[model samples]
Target: MAFSLFILFLIIGVIEIYAFQAVKTFTKVKWVRLCYVIISLMSIVFIVYQFTRFDRSVGQTPMFMITVGLMLLVLIPKLLITSVLILEDGLRLIVGSRNYFNNYDKEASFLPERRRFISKVALGIAAVPFLSLIYGMTVGKYNYKVLRHTLFFDDLPDAFDGFKITQISDIHSGSFDNPEKISYAVDLINEQESDLLLFTGDIVNTNATEMHPWIDTFKKIKNHEFGKYSILGNHDYGEYVEWKSEELKNKNFEDIKDLHRQIDFKLLLNENTKLKKGNDEIALVGVENWGVKFKKVGDLNKASENLKKEDFKILMSHDPSHWDAEINTHEKDFHLTLSGHTHGFQFGIEIPGVIKWSPVEYVYKQWAGLYVNMERYLYVNRGFGFHAYPGRVGIMPEITVLELKKRKKVV
Candidate 1:
C-alpha cells in the first residue's frame, strides 16, 4: 500500500508540475504564478497528511472533507489539461515527422515550440470541468431530485393498481455537512405524498453513530399510508471499520439496526412481509446486504419462503448486482426489485433518453435508473446522500417515486 501511494503521489506531482509550467507561460504576473505553485504543492501535501492520519473506524471528519475538496480542485483541472496536452502532442509528433521527412534535412531540429494558441485552447477547455466540479461540490451535492416512474405489471393485484412507493437509498448520513439541507430532503419526500416509503440500504457510512446527528431530521419523514421499510446495505454492517473487539463490532451492528426502529422504519433482514389492500395482497421481500463482491448474507429463497408463485412481489436488495446474479434467475419471479448501492457513481452525464453515461457503468451493470427483463423490473435509485467525496456532480441526490399499475388486458 505504501509503495502504491508513493507511485501515485509521484505521478500527480509530475502532472502538477506540467500544469504549473503551462500556467506560468499563460500568466504575466510573477506573484500570481508563484501563488499558484504554492497552492498546488500545499494541496498535495495536505492530502498526503490527511490520509496518513486517517482512521477507518472513525469514518469521515471535517479534515477529511477539506482534504478531499482540495484534492479534487487540483486534480480535476490538471487531468483535463493533461488530456488536451496529450492529444496536441500526438498531433505534433505526426506533423513534425512529416515536415522532417519532406524537407530531408538531417541536421534540422525535429521538435519545435508548441503553439501559444494550442496552450490557450488547452487551458480554455480545462476550465469547463474545473468550474463544473467546483459547482458540484458547493451546490450539486445537496440538490435533491425526485424521479417519478409508473411501472405496469400484469401480476399486480387489483387493489394495488395505483399504489405509490417513494424509494430512497444509500443515505450515507455520515457525509452530510448541513442539517438544514437534509431536513429539506426529508420534506421533499413528504411532498410527494406517496402511499409507501422504502429505503434500500446504506443508512450510514461506517458506524451507527453517524445517524445520531440526523435522527431528528430523518424522523420527520411523513408517515406513509401503508408504512416505511428498509433493507441493509453493504456499508451498514460496520465491516469497513477496525473494531477493538468482536463484541464491540456486534454491538455496533445491533445499534445500527435499532437506529432504523428509532426512525420508525421496519428493518427487514432476510425476511418477507405482506402489504394488504382490502382482500388482495402483495409480498414485499427484503434481504440483507448481498453483492457479487460484497457481503452475501441475503437469502432470496428464505425471503420468499411462504409466498405463492402468482403473488405480486417486490424485493428490496442493496446492490443492483443481486438482481442479475440471483433475483432475475430465481425460480420465483420478483415483479419489482429496488437497489441504490452505486450512487450513480456520484458523477455522470444523465440527459434522460439522449444519453446516460457514468464511469461506474463499467463496474456495475445496473448502476442507476430502471431496467426490465422477462416481466421483472429493477429500479436503481441514485442515492439520497453523498458518501466519500461529500459532494455530487452530474448525478445529484435522488428521491425515486414509483407508482404501481396493473396492466389492463385487451378485449
Candidate 2:
C-alpha cells in the first residue's frame, strides 16, 4: 500500500510539473507566470499534506471538505490537461515521423500554431471536468431523486398484490455533514408511505459511533404499516477500521445492531419473517453482509430454514453479487431480492433505458436498478448517502419506491 501510494503521488507530481510548464508557456506576463507556478506548487504540497494526514473520523468536517475540494480543483484539471497533451503529442509524433521519412533534404520546422492551439484547447477542455467535479461536490451530491417502479409477479401473494416497499441503502452516516438535508430525506421516504420500508445496510462508514449523531434525525422516518426491515451491508461489519482489541470491535458491531433497534428497524441477520394480510402470506428473508470479495457470512439455507419451496420470497442481501452467486441458483426460487453495495460507484450516467455506465459495472454485475431473470428478480438501490469520494457525480442519492403488483393470468 505504501509503495502504491508513493507511485501515485510520483505520477501526480510529474503531471503537475508538466501542467505548470504549460501555464508558463501560455502566460506571457512574468508576474502571472511566477504566481501560477507558486500556486501550483503550493497546491501540490497541500494535497500531499492533507491526504497523508487525513483522518476518516473527521471525514465530513469543514476542514476535510476544503482539503478535498482544493485537491480536486488542482488535480482534476492537471490530469485532464495531461490527457489532452498526450493525445496531441501522439498525433504530432506520427505526423513528424512521416514527414522526416519523406523529405531527407528538406528542413522541417515545428508548427508553432499547432503547439499554441493544442495548449489552448487542452486548457479549455481541462476546465470542463474541473467545473463538473465542482458541481458534483456541491449540488449534485445531495440531489435526491425518487425512482418509482411497479413490479408484477405471478407468484406474488394476493395480500401483497398492491403492496408498496420503500428501499434506501448505503447510508454512510459518518459522511453526512448536514442534519437538515437528512431530515428532509427522511420526510421524502415517509411521503411514499409504503407498506414495507427496507434499508439494505451500510448505516455507518466504519465505526458504530458514526451513527450516534444522526440517530435522532433518522428516527423521524416512519416505519409505515408493516414496519421497517433492514439487512447488514459489508461496511456494517466494522472491519475497515483499526480497533485496539477484538472486544472493542465486537462492541462496535453490537452497538450498530442496537442502533437499528433504536431507529425502530427490525435488524434481520440470516432470518426470515412472514408478512401476512388476512390468509395470504409472503416470506421476507434477510441475510447478513454477504459479498463476493467481502465477508460471506450470509447463510441462505439458514435464513430459509423454515421457508417452503413454493413460498413467495423476497430476499434482502446487501451485495448484489449474492443474488447471482447463491440466491438465483437456490432450489427455492427467490422471487425478489434487494441489494445496494456498489452505490453505482457513487458515479455514473443513468438515462433510464438510454445509457447506464459506471466503472463499478466491471466489478459488480448487478450494480443498480432492477435486474430480472426467469422468475427471480433483484433491485439494487443507488444508496442514501456518500462514502469514500465524499460526493456523488451523475449518480445522486436515491430513494427507491417499489410498488408490488400481482400479474394476471390470460384465459
Candidate 3:
C-alpha cells in the first residue's frame, strides 16, 4: 500500500513539472522555469513524506526509504509552483481595479505579463478549494448508487414486524479524531426514529485508546425496541499495527471488545442471541470480521449453536463479500443479514431512480442500500464517518434506516 501510494504521488509530481513547463509558454525564462520545476517537485516530495510518516513505516528496508525519497522528489516541485502562483496572484490583485483583458500584456515580455497571468492563475487556484467545498457539501452528501439489492425477501420475520433498521458502517472512531462532528451524527441517528439500530462493523478506527474520548457521545445512540447490535470491521481488529507481542495484541483486541460492552453493543463473535418481540423469537447472529482477505476464521456454527431449527435468523457480517462468497450458498441461509464496509468508494451518484457508479461497486455487489437474493436480504450501510481522507469528498455520511417488513404466508 505504501509503495503504491508513493508511486502514485511521484506520478503526480512529474505531471506537475510538465504542467509548469507548459505554463512556461505563458511565462518564459529557461532559468526561471528550471528553478520553478526543481523547487516545486522538491517541495511536494517533502510535504508528502512529512504527511504520510514515511520514516515510521520503514518496513521494506531500503525500498521504503527509496519510495519516501521519490515521494519527496515528486511532492516538492508541485508544492513550490502552487505557492509561487499564490504570491504572484496577491501581487496582481492588490493593484487597483482593471479588467483582466485590459491588464493583459501582449509584447512587453513574460515578466511584464506576470500580473494578469498570475491573477488568472490565482483565480484558478481559488476556484479549486471553493469548488471542493461546494462538492463536499452538496453532491458529496447526496450521492450514492444502489449496487445490487437483497430487498426482496420472502422469509422476513414479523418478529421485527415493521422494523426499519438504520445501519451505519465503519464510523472509524479514530478518524473522527474530531469530536463535534461525531456528536452531530449521533443527533441525526437519534432523530431518525429507526425501528432497530445496527452498526455493521468498524465502530472505531483502531484500538480501545482511540475510542476512549468519545464514549459519552456514542452512548447517546438511540435504538428501537428490537435493540441495537454490532459486528467488527477490519480496523476494529487492531491487526495492521505492530504490538509488543502477540499476547499484547490479543490483550489490546480484548480491551476494545470490552469497550463495546460499555457502549451496550453485543459483540457477536460467531455468536447468536434471541431478539424477542412479544412471542416472536428471531435469532440475530453476528461474527467477528468474516471477510475474504481479512479473516474468515470466525465460527458461524458456534454462533448458531443455541438457534432452534425453526427460528428466523439474521447475520451481521461486516463484509458483504462474505454473503455472496460463502453465506449465500451456505446450507442454511439467514432470513436477513446486515453489513457495511464499503462507504460507496466515498464517491458515486445516488439520486431518486437514476443512480449509478461507485468504485466500491467493483468489489461489492451489495455495496450500498438493499439487496435481495431469493429469500435472503442484506443491507450494506454506506458508512457514517470518513476514512483515509478526513473529509468525505463525494460521499455523504449515511444513517441507513432499514424497514424490515414481514413476508406473508407462502401457502
Which ranges of candidate 1 are over 4 A from the true structure? 1-6, 94-110
Top-TM-score candidate index: 1
Q: What is the Å distance of residue 102 in model 3 from its true position? A: 41
TM-score to true structure, per model: 0.95, 0.92, 0.72
Q: Which stretch of 10 consecutive residues in model 2 shows the poorest summed lDDT? A: 105-114
Model 1 clash pairs?
none
Question: Deviation in angstroms for 404 in model 2?
Answer: 0.7
Clashing pairs in 2: none
Q: Arrange candidates, best lDDT first.
A: 1, 2, 3
* lDDT per residue (tens digit) for residues 40-116 in model 2: 88887886787778764333444566777788778878988888777777887777777777774356554222476
Task: List candidate 2 segments past 4 Å from native.
Answer: 1-6, 54-72, 98-114
lDDT of 1 by residue, 327-402 (tens): 9888888999999999998989989889999999999999999999987899999999887776788999999999
After TM-score superposition, the amount by which residue 287's alpha carbon in candidate 1 deviates from its true location, in angstroms, is: 0.3
